[model samples]
Target: MTDLIAELDPTQWYRDGRGPRYKQLHRHIRGLVSSGDLAAEDQLPSEREIADRAQISRVTVRKAIAELVADGLIEQRHGAGSFVRASSNRFEQSLSSLVSFTENLQARGITSASRVLLKGLFRPTPTEAMVLGLSPHHQVARINRLRSGDGVPMALEYSSLPEDVLPRPDKIDLSLYELLRARGTAPTRAIQRVIAVNATAPVADLLDLAEGAAVLQIERTAYLASGRPIEFTSGIYRSDIYDFVSELRLD
Candidate 1:
C-alpha cells in the first residue's frame, strides 16, 4: 500500500488552487482512485506516512481523510485503518442540485414516505431568525416532518419559511418542493452544512434510536433563482441509514 501511494505526484495539490491544503489533498486521493492506481478495497497509507510523504502536518492528513470518508470514498476500521469502500454509496447522493426528496429517493429505488409532524404558522426563534434571515418578530411557516425511506426512518426535518410568501399549511403535501413549485416559490439552489452528532431524546424518539445514538445533523438554506431565501431547514438523520455524498472533481 505504501509503495502504491508513493507513486502519486506530490505536485497535484499545489497545481490545484481550488481550496485549502486539506481539500487539495482530498482531490489528490480522489485522483488516485479514478486513475485505477488505487485498486478497489485497497488500504490507504497511514496518516503519519502520508503526512511525511506530502510534507504536510498529520492534522492536515486527517482532515483530508475525513472529507473522503464523508464523500463515501473510504471507510475506517477499528484497528485496521482506512480502506476504499464499496462504490454503491458514491452514486447515492443528491445533496444539492434542487431535486425533490420523493424524486431523489425513487430514482435510487428506495421507498420514501413522509409523516407530517406539524404544518402551521409560528414566530421564529432567535436561532431560526438567524437561519431564515427574518425579523426579530416575524411570522414563519414551520413544517416539521419525519422522512423515511424503505420503511426505515431517515431524518427529522425541521423547516421554516417567511409566512408572507408561503401558502397556508393545509395546502402542503408530502413533497415540499412540489408545493413550492405550485406556489411559484421553488428552490433553485441550496447550501448545506453536515456534522456528526449524538441524538437527544426527541431526535431518538423520532428516529427510533437509543439515546445518544450517532446522527448526521444537516443545516440547510434553500434559495430561489432570484436569490430570495426560500426555506431554512435543520435535519437530524440516522447515520446508519443515511449518508451524504458528492464528487469533487480533481485536476
Candidate 2:
C-alpha cells in the first residue's frame, strides 16, 4: 500500500491547477481505489505517515479521508484507523451512457445473465400507460427479469413496452436493447430517475439482500430517435453493491 501511495506523482496533482490540496489528495486516493490498486478492507496509511511521506499537512489528509468516508469508499474504525470498504460486489455505473445491464457488465469482463420472472402482453398499469404514451385500449409487453453478474443476482428489472413496439417477449434472449435494435425500434436516448428505498421481501430475496435493506430504485424511459417513448423500466439495485456516478462540467 505504501508503494502504491508513493507511485502517485505529486506533479500530476498540480496539473489540475493546484486546487484544494485535500481535494487533490482525495481524488488521488479515490483513483487508486477505483483502479483496483486498493482492494476492499485494505488499511490506509496512517494520517501522520501519509502526511510526512506526501509532504502534506495532517489536516489535508484528514479532510480528504473524511470525504472518502462520506462517499462510502472508506470506513473508519475507532482505534483501527481507516480501511477500504468492500466493493467486490459494487459497480460504479455512469448515468450519461445509455447502456444495458449486459453491456455494462461485459465492459468489466463479467458474465451477464438473466432469469425471466414474467413476460407477455398485459394490460398497462396507470403509470405505465402515462409514461409509455399508451392508449386505454393498448396492451403492453411486460418483461420482468432478474439480472445477474457472474451468476450472482444483482438487480430486479421490470420493463413495459407498447405491444406495437415489442409484440412478442419470446424474441428476447440476452439483451432487450439487442432485440429492440433487431426490430429497428431501439432507443437512442433515455431519461432516468433514481431514489433510495427499502427492499421488500421479494425484491430482497431476488437480490440476495436482507428484507428492508437499502436499495436503489431507478425509473427510466427510453426514447427513439424520433423522440417516441419506446420502453419504460423500473429496477431495484442492491445499494451495498452498486454506485451510480454522474460527471459534470463547469463550462
- Which residue pairs in candidate 2 collide? none
Give me the runs in candidate 1 sitting further than 4 Å from their true place: 1-91
Q: Tell me the number of clashing residue pairs for each predicted model.
A: 0, 0
What tens-digit string does per-residue lDDT give for candidate 2 at 217-247? 9999999999999999999987666899999
TM-score of each: 0.61, 0.66
Best prediction by TM-score: 2
Best candidate, lDDT = 2
Prediction 2 global C-alpha lDDT: 0.82
Query: Per-residue lDDT for 81-196 in model 1, tens only?
Result: 99887572422455756776677888889788989999898888987787667897788888889998777667898888888767486577788888888778887889999998
